[model samples]
Target: EAGVVQSPRYKIIEKKQPVAFWCNPISGHNTLYWYRQNLGQGPELLIRYENEEAVDDSQLPKDRFSAERLKGVDSTLKIQPAELGDSAVYLCASSKRTGGQEKLFFGSGTQLSVL
Candidate 1:
């Protein structure tokens, strides 16, 4: 099968602009995740979805960021009124199931630039 797919591989916006990213995970994968990575840092889990339900989102900035996995398949992540500090790479990953040792497949990621 195919790996995860992300659209608009790159985005550039001014501060306070709204931006969105899309992801399509591999078929049969029951768990999906959204992560953000700043320069020189590892990807940080922003949200995790098991099927269509969001299972973990503690690291997500609810005030300006939101995500949704519809029908346990495709997902979208949005950031409204993005700040200059929000410039980073947004990554989408998925796995067959959720577990401590399960391997994850990651998309190339959407690189965001806020000026």
Candidate 2:
């Protein structure tokens, strides 16, 4: 019944610091996604999870970024040694269906500022 939930709506940190974001997808949802949106740009998928398995994560920067969806429910995204370029809105979304035609419900997003 609830929509996607994300914590720490905003975060500010210096470059090289580590940051983490949390997400709780809607109940019964089978698909979850993490996306990054730079200013004036559309959200770009960072990772996508079908239940507990990460089905797509090629866009995620592995060196300093990591994510996990445990128990096919909640998920977390972390960025270590973050750079200024990492400043952006991190969005979490979920869908009940795996088909491409299904609509995704998005959370408010975490706004990160790396100085």
lDDT of 1: 0.96
Clash-forming residue pairs, model 1? none
| Residue-wise C-alpha lDDT for candidate 2, range 1-115, written one tens digit per residue | 6789999899999999999999999999999999999999999999999999999999999999999998999999999999999999999999996868989999999999999
Which 10-residue window of candidate 1 scores lowest in summed lDDT? 65-74
The local lDDT score (0 to 100) that residue 104 gets in candidate 1 is 95
Off by over 4 Å in 1: none
RMSD of 1: 0.6
Candidate 1's residue-wise lDDT over 1-115, tens digit each?
8899998899999999999999999999999999999999999999999999999999999999999987889999999989999999999999999978999999999999999
- Output the number of the TM-score-best candidate: 1
Instruction: Show where candidate 2 strays beyond 4 Å.
Output: none
Per-model TM-score on C-alpha atoms: 0.98, 0.97
Please list all clashing residue pairs in model 2, or write none if there are none. Answer: none
**Model 2 lDDT on a 0 to 1 scale:** 0.96
**lDDT of each prediction vs. the true structure?**
0.96, 0.96
Q: By summed lDDT, which 10 consecutive residues of candidate 2 come out lowest?
A: 95-104
